[model samples]
Every structure is written in structure tokens, then in C-alpha cells.
Target: EEPYVAVVYSDYLHLVCSSCFHEDAPLLIRKCKEAPLEACKGCHEVYYCGSACQQNDWKIHEAECKFLSTAVAVPSDIVRMIARLLIRRKRGDHDTFRAYNGRKFDDLMDHRSDFENMGANFDKVFNDTKNYVSIDYMVDREEIVRYVGKLLVNQFAIRGPVDTCIGNGLYIGICIFDHSCQPDLTRRSIGSKMILRSQNREQTLNKNLTVSYISPLACTEERRKLLRSNPFFFHCKCRKCEDTEQDGYARSIKCESCEGGICLVKDDSAPLRCMKCGITSSITHEEANKWNADVAIVEYFGSEDCALFIRKSMHIFSPPNMRDLAKKQS
Candidate 1:
């Protein structure tokens, strides 16, 4: 008796489970020899050898089942071409199984004119802002070209079944969102299904708001640098990035004399007047000069070292319990 087999189509080939081929003719036809006649109970599109094999593969297949079910049957010619591409990559000296990064395969073939227009529009937007934007003129053009080409190729090769089942749906309008150092939105993926949600305190999204896809750990300067360098072509003037003068350091400072909050400037000449208490005390010119020198020395020691020193300094000046509370807040 031969071992039972299970076969399914994905990416560029019909995947067959090597150990699952069985001797029973009808069972073989229903399981490994071709597309499964009986779909998995939960996601009724995937075929398995039996209840046992389905149970075993459930963990891996559950997430992808919905996506797989929605894929339209590829034409025999297209499937063959894709299979050849995969085989050539396996046999060739160079790596050819590169992932596609651009438009969907179905979309690219059906909407070539739309993509060309989009590309032209993107270029026009970039060119219009040349005066205000300080773009990195020496970016590697080859990398951009390669990325775009891969995207187009992938778009043509991978046609989702949902294309036919689902109506002629418009593409998700996410291009307008400019990059931000601290984005308000977060994205979650369950298998191939993507869900976007608000991560910030706001309950409702405002008009003209754009969603972000990047992590928000980056500081303002790093975010701006990315925006300037990327194909997105827009300098982020978001509130967090633009308000450099009000960085986290200024919010952390507390007055030693009255325990009142004080906002300090980078230069450390005289602390800004406290809004809570109307008193403004001026640091003498000598003291200001010394403070600037100290800041330079602290910065030279590196940020992590400087932060540790500041924590120790705070502990020396403040109550022990207060230091614990500050650490907790941080």
C-alpha cells in the first residue's frame, strides 16, 4: 500500500505531499493525485488525506485557507509559464525566485494604463515640490527600477481568485498618507487578510487624515531623513517632527527651587518662565556658558551614558521615592 498524498496549488506550482500517496484509486484521486474533492471542514477549500491528516495540518492551513479559497483558477498556459519560471530558478546559477513587490498580477495586466498614469502623477508631485524639498539627488536609481519591475512582474503572476468572486473593487487608497515619525495608525495581518486600526486616543478618523505603515519608535530627525530619501517624495511636517523645540527633554525638567515644572531650551541660558509660577530667574552669563559646556561634555559621552548620569543626578537631588516614581513614568 502506498502512503496517502495531498496536493494543492500555491505561488507557481502544484504542491504534493511526498509521504501521503495511497493505493486506493478513488481516495488517491480525491487526495494527492489532483485537487481535493472534499475540502477541510473549517475552511472548505483545502483537501487533506483524511480526518487525521486534516487535523495535523490544521494549524498551518487555517490561516491561509481563506486566501487560498479566493484564488481564481489560473489558465493552463499561464500556470505552465509560471511553473517553468520556478523550475528555471531552481536549476539556474542565479537566484530567480525573488518576491514580487508591486501591483497584483491581475491588476497589472488589466490596468496597465492606470499604473502608467499613477507613475506619471507620482513624478509630477515630486517635481512640483523640488524647491521646498531637499531630496537626496544621488539615490541609486537601479534599486528603484528593480523594485518597480519586480512589483509589476509579481502583479502579473499572482492572480487572486477573489478577483472574480469579489466585485471589481477599487484599490485601497493608502498612497496619500505621508510618512510620520509618530504615526497614529497600526496594521495587523491575519494570514493574507490585512486590518488597519487606530493606535492613538482618537475615536473617529478626521477628514484628510492619512494612515502610516512604519514603526513609530524613530525620532523626528530620523523620520525626516527617511521621507527625504524614499520615493514618497514628501518631507514630513507632522506636529511631532516639526516641534523640535518641544522635545521630550524640555518636558522632563523640574525646577529645583520650587518643585515647579520648567521647560528648558537647548542652550540652557535661562530656563523658560514657568506657567504655573510667574517667577522667572535668569542664569548669569558665566553660568549659562558653563551649562553649555557641560551639555557638550554630556553629549560627547553618548546619549545612553548621559541618560544614566542624569538618572543618578536626579536621584541625588530628589527623594528616593520620587526617583522610583520617575523611573516608573519613564
Candidate 2:
């Protein structure tokens, strides 16, 4: 049977080596035979294979390590323990005696008493180093449980797994960029490290733009629908969604003043407002092309330029033929 896998959403707790962009040294330890004689002298948490690798990485690693160490504030030992537990849980090599579905996973975890000893050890460590370690802050219990459950189901505990090659569950911080119909981010995997690259030529983005982890290839309506149903409960009120012209293709509404050219905003109380003119007028579905001609074009183009072209052509001149527009965009 194929092993269960979990997709861990990236967060902000991981430390990456500057020299190699490696997420964790313990994961790298598998690749190297000899351990460094001395750990990172300042941040005792991160060890190295040798002084050469450490020295080579000092310039970038030092600043990032200092910032991370200060911000995270948790003890290295505790974090390592959590990581080990995750790794152990991911290594499920024995025959699938049981299905290990979500129900079974919950049942096993409900037997918290089985792992009570480990909890005791945690408490002991916390009590012993009360001054050195910060324990007052509350962690999201559900997040930890979900992650630990993933680790156990994946059997990362036993090691030798391809997914565990870089150690999963650790959150590496990446700069946030705003969502767009056309996104600039690209994911590249090098060994165990997943690198996010900016496909755009510009090195810096504007201040007003918001950053998002998800892809922006989806249509405005589809994106809105996803935002509504997603765990993150918030409607996306982006400029794209506000465009009545685009909504016309979704069979939303049409403006009477502009004939078939302008689309109307859909609201029971709000009258149909022409997108081109500020005229408040309504039209029937028969008057306008009930089907969206631009949607197919936008889907084929899959880029900001295509969206811009469609918006301009529809609003200004005649709406382009879907086939010709789609081919050009593609």
C-alpha cells in the first residue's frame, strides 16, 4: 500500500542555511559523515558538518539565525524533540495492519495516556529550565496535533523515506507577495529544499500589493467562490472581482444603456449600473450574450496581458472572437 502523505502549508518558524539554502542541519547530517567539532558557537541550536561549511555560510546565516532565534524564543531541545516525533510518525514501514484513516488516527491520538510519559518528560524539561526556556506562550493545539498526526501517518519516524530527505513539517519563511490574476512566483525543488523564485523581471514589488501563497491562474468568479468556501473565511474584494465587465460573462447582469457592451452589477437592491457610463439601467439576459465570450479567452491566455486586452477590447471596441482571442492569448 502507498504511504499516506500530507501537504504542509509553509509558515514562519524554519531556519535555512545561507550557503546551501538547507532548511535544517539535522536533515543535512544524513548527507555528511563527520559532525562539526563545535556547534554554531553563538546559536548552540544549529550544528554544522565542519567549520568550512559554517564559515562559508556565516555572512548570510548569522543575521537570519539571530533574527529567527530571537523571534522564535523556543528552546532548541524542545523543537528537536517535536521534529524527531514527526520524523518517527512518518516512518510507517510495517504492513498496513489497519487502514490508518482519519478515524483511526484520531483514536490513536485519543490514547494520549499512551504518550503521557513523553508529556511528563516535557514538563520536567520545562520545569528544570524555567528561566532559560519560555513556556507561558500558548501554541495552537489543533495545529500541533494536525502536524504530529501527519508525521505519524506518513511514518517519517523510521527514516529512509524520500519525503523525509529534507525533513517535512518545518516552516521556512518566504517573503509574501500579493495575489494577482497573473502570479510571479514559481516553486523549484532542489533535493530537499523547495525554493520560491520570482518569475517577474522586477526585483521589488509595489507597496499596495498584497502577497499570497496560492496560484492566481483561476478566473475572478472561481477565485471568489474558492475564497468563500475556504477555511480562511473572507470574501476577496479585489479589483478583479469588482469589475462588472468580467462578471457579465458569468451571466451576472447587463447594462441597458450600453446595449450588450457594458455589464451590470448584481445586487437585489442596487440597480444595474452601466460599466462604461455611470447610467443606471437594466437589460434582460436575451439582450446580452448570456455566455461569456471573454472567459474562454482569459482562460486560454492565462496572463495579465490577456486580461488587460480582453477588458479593453470588450469595453472600447467590439468583443473579440473567442477562438481568435484564445489562440492569441495562448
Candidate 3:
């Protein structure tokens, strides 16, 4: 709990109480004053649940208040956390750099080679952050870029009481686990701190544990792609990815030749192979394009919203296509 660093809630994310980092904050804004929620005299963009929280947070908030007051465009979320860390470090808060389980900032992997390997896109993001969020305190631009790189891979996107994301933080302690398609540990947020527990209650008999960073229901390809793209820039050799494409096959259509066989394809360009009868099926450009667009919308929405989105998509796809997808999800 001592290591839990609560970030300043951004109005951009509709968060309440920059101190406690609660969500749906605007709903509580009106009554916050008489309810004794204090607004910052500097920039009313943020608020506090009480004076104690305001006082405890001000050490880190001073620079952000100054930055927010002057800037026309708000800094991105990553920059704000980095700014807080920097401010805390300047204030002699050693805990700011110390990660959970006795790990230091230097201990986390920076992915320097990975960023360099990304080439053009890396330069674009790096340059954009520097140009947009460069503060006067850090004279060297490379320092900020380094912090950004470490954070991109190491930071956790914090969730609130609502499923919506409220802020981002670097949990030095929780960063110890490696990736597994079927993780042994799961996490839930309670106020500012995240609580982690063994997926199997009996499994906790052994203290050492691991957790999966991504959703297990995801196919091997989706899991690998997610791991490789962001901070953890490596291919996953987890049991699920190593075993079979059954999950991918489950989500895919039946083979055209052998309607009983599941059709398995690595990507849009690859031909779908029949798991039972071994039929290789080719997908048209139009079919692939529409399938991707529909998948994106379906995955992004909540359960209630997903059904409505799928219902809307029914107008675009053929009945046969919808029936196949319905079977896949089931």
C-alpha cells in the first residue's frame, strides 16, 4: 500500500477527486464543495476529497498545476505520470523510483533496442512527445524519452469502480510476473491500490506466482500480437500459444468443403485450412475487410453494447456469416 502511487485524475477521463482518483467525478462535482471537496485555487481542473488528500498530493501537484495553467493543450497521460515521478524525485521521495518487491527503476526493462527496431514509428512518437510535452525542468530531451520508454512497457493502466480506465501508474511490485496465456493470478482494483490473488485459492500454498497480462480467451495469434506490439515486445511461447490453434479455430468459420471441420487461418492473407477434412479455403478481399471491421466494433463494446453492435452488423453480413460467428462465440 505504501508503494501505491495515485495519479491526478484527468477531466479528459471524467475522473473525480484528483487525490483518490475516483471515476464518474463530474456527477459529484456540484455537491463536492459543501460536501467539503476542495478545488485547487490554481487550476480548477482537479479537485480533492478533503484537505488531507490535497495537502498530501500538493508536493507532486505543484508542477502539474503550473504546467496545466500555462499549456493550451493538456499533456498526454504518460507525460503527467512521468512529471509526477520527476517532481517526487526532486522532493527526495525515494519511494517514487523504488518499484514493488525491492525493485528499482533501473531494474525494469527499457526496451531500447525494441524501440530502435520499430524504426520510423518509434521516432514519430518520441519526437511528438518531446515536442508536445517537453517541460522546462528537464533540459535534456533524451531523459524524458527514456522515462517514456520504460513506462510504456512497465506502467499499468489503472481502472476504477467503473470498468472505465481512470489513470495510469507504475506498480513496481506487481511487475514481477511473466506472461502466460492461462495466468495463475488475477488482479482487481480497490481504491488506488490493486489487489492480486491466485486464480486457484489452493495454488497460493506456494508463495511464488505468475499472471497473464492479456485475456486468456484470446487466440494464440491475438495474444502473441498484443504482447509483441506494446511494452513487452516479444513473442509469447505460453502453453496456449505452444499447444494448438483450437481457440482460433473455435472463433473461425466451418470449412466450405467439409462443413463439419473448423476453418483455421493465421491472418487475412493466409488460406483457412480445415481441421477435419484438410480443405484450404481462400477469403476474398471484401470478406476479409468486412470481417476485420466488424470484429473491431464487437470487441470494443461492453456486453450489452456488443449485442446491439452485433445486431447493427447483421445488416451488413450475410445470414451464413452471422450463423458462423454465432457458433464461434458459443
Candidate 4:
């Protein structure tokens, strides 16, 4: 699938082939050609393996050349990405580019109101966009803001074969897949392209495919917090997000009544009920905060003794609590 717009990060300008976005390695770089990489005569901001590669990307880069040539410094990854998108939209690229299901670029979701409610955060982005993008390429102020919000929420990290992030891109089809903490599909990247595959035989017949937008290893609450921030400003209603009992088990407290653990009950303000012994235990806010802090310290510091001490204090949820396993092995 072709990307609607993509830009290699500034830090990787020289290392990656801007046109093909081939991985940076001696052998791979040599595979393209031993000839020294060429920089755009106008901007010197992008690099290509050879003239042919440069020519291939020239269509998109042509619009950016003039702006980049006169700029004081190279724009940021997101900034450059947004500029390319704006240029494409102004030139009517959105009308011709379609997803697998024939969804046009204009069909993409735009959370303009959400960004508007963001106040100063949204203001900074809008101002930065205006500063970098030339006046000729820009649309009305509201239209630019709408595109900015759309790109923020829909852009994907262009990662290389080894799973190293090389750039950012906007793919119309990939954007259609919704986010889930527990996804039914697996995704891998090759250069500027992404490949999604069903995880199991059952998933092949499934209609509602999903992929993790955030790290699945993170606790449910942490994942939810991230999903509700900057790029994704919506609460998740995935199976994992709705599993309140499972979430409580992850942060369970020790129950003194039956030497069992008591998990926090979702949507209930009363005392927690022990999952094992059916006894109620009242815990203070301070206690919960302390437990969370201790877990964080052990995870960050990787002190085996500290982990063991914490492990003995509660009934840890299995598998996801790999730290406990490591502590036990230690």
C-alpha cells in the first residue's frame, strides 16, 4: 500500500534513503549502490541512494524543496509530515488516493473540536505549522487545524525490518484498524511499509480486526491513560479495558482476614472483597499509592530482593507478572 505522505526523521536524514526508506547498514546501503548518497540541491535536508531513487520521490519532495531551502532549520518529524500532507491536499492528491476499500483521504477522521478544547497545546501546534509551512501551501486556519488533528491521531511510525523506527507516515487503510489492548492481529514493519496478519486461524474469519496502539505489557490503567492522551483522546472499550476484575488482580492488596488477596472492586467505593476467602478489607488511599510506587521502583531498579519482598506481600496476576517470575528465579 502506498503512503499518502511520509517523511524520514531529521536525525536519520543522511542514514536512510529518503525515497525508498531502505534500512541503514553497510550491506543494505551497498546493495542499492556504492555511489555516495545525494542530497537535494535545493534543501540538502533529504538524502537518496542514487539519482533514480531521488527522481522517484521528487514528485512529493518538489513541493517541499522551496520551503525547506529558505527555512532557518529543518522542521520536526511531525511538522515536515504535516507540511507534506498539506501540500498533497492542496494539490488534490486526496481525491485520487484511495484505500483498499476505496476510502478517500478526505474520509479520514478529523478531531478538530477535541484539539480546540486542548487550548494552549493545540495553539502551539497550529502556530508551529504556520511558521514552517509556506503561505502558498496552507489552507484556511480551521482547515489546517483539522488536518493537524487528523494526522496526529492517524499517523504510523515507519519502522525498518529490525523494528527500529525510521520515520512517520500516513496510511489510509492501516488507519481503519481500531486500537485494542488485546489485539487479534500482529503487525510488522519493513522500511516505510507495514504488514498486518491474523494472529490465529480463528482471526482470519473475524471481521473486526484490531492492533495495539500502545504497549500491551503496560498495566490496564497505564494503557488507558496513554490512549486518552495527545494522539488518541478517547476511552478504550476493548475487552481488556472492560475486564475490571483482571485489572484489579494486577494491583491486588494482601487480605489479613484469610491470608488471601483482596482486589479492588470497579465502580464500587466500599471495602474490597477477597477473591480467595470472601472477606472484606478496607484499604486507605495512601496504602494503594505506596503499593503502586513500590512496584514501580522494583520494575525500574530491577532489584531482585526488592521484587521478592513485594511479591510476598500480594497475590500477583500470572504471566503479566513476569517480574515476579524473574524475582523467583533470582
Count of backbone clashes for each model? 13, 17, 2, 0
Q: State residue 65's C-alpha deviation in candidate 3, in Å.
A: 1.6
lDDT of each: 0.35, 0.39, 0.59, 0.69
Q: List, residue by residue over 1-330, the lDDT tens digit for candidate 1.
A: 110111223321222221132222233233333543344655455444556555665544443344335444322322222222222323441232221223222222223344454463333222222221123321233322332332322211111221111101112223223445445443332112233456344546543555553333334455566555423445788775677654324222344346644434333344544444645535443442343233322312344766666655462222432342233222
For TM-score, candidate 1 versus 2, the one ahead is 1
Candidate 3 lDDT by residue in tens digits, 1-330: 333344644653324567666543444323224354567778666777667667867877777687667666666666666666566656666444564466666566777778768761444444444554435554355665676787777776666654556677677678767768656666555545666766355664232566667655555666788988867888888766886654444345545665456555344456666668887756553464456445543333345666665576564443444654453232
Q: Rank the candidates by TM-score, best first.
A: 4, 3, 1, 2
- Per-residue CA lDDT of model 2 for 1-330, tens digit only, reads 112221211221234332332344444443433443345667654545456657854644454345336644544433433433333333431123233222222233222332343342334333323334234322345434443433332222111122223333222122223455434444333423444445455646433444343334344556666555422234777655676455433334434456665443332335545567777655433333333433433432336867676666553323323333444454
| lDDT accuracy of residue 42 in candidate 2 | 70
What C-alpha RMSD separates each model from the true structure?
19.0, 17.7, 6.8, 7.6
Residue pairs with clashing backbones, model 4: none
Q: If scored against the real structure, what TM-score would every candidate get? A: 0.30, 0.29, 0.66, 0.71
Q: After superposing candidate 2, which stretches have Cα over 4 Å from the reference?
A: 1-85, 88-171, 178-200, 205-217, 246-330
Residue 28 shift from truth in candidate 4, angstroms:
5.2
Off by over 4 Å in 1: 1-176, 182-184, 199-207, 249-330
Output the worst ten-in-a-row residue range by lDDT, candidate 4: 316-325
Winner by TM-score between candidate 3 and candidate 2 = 3
Please report how far candidate 4 places residue 240 from its true position, in Å: 2.0
TM-score (C-alpha, index-matched) for candidate 3 = 0.66
Ranking of all candidate structures by their lDDT, best first? 4, 3, 2, 1
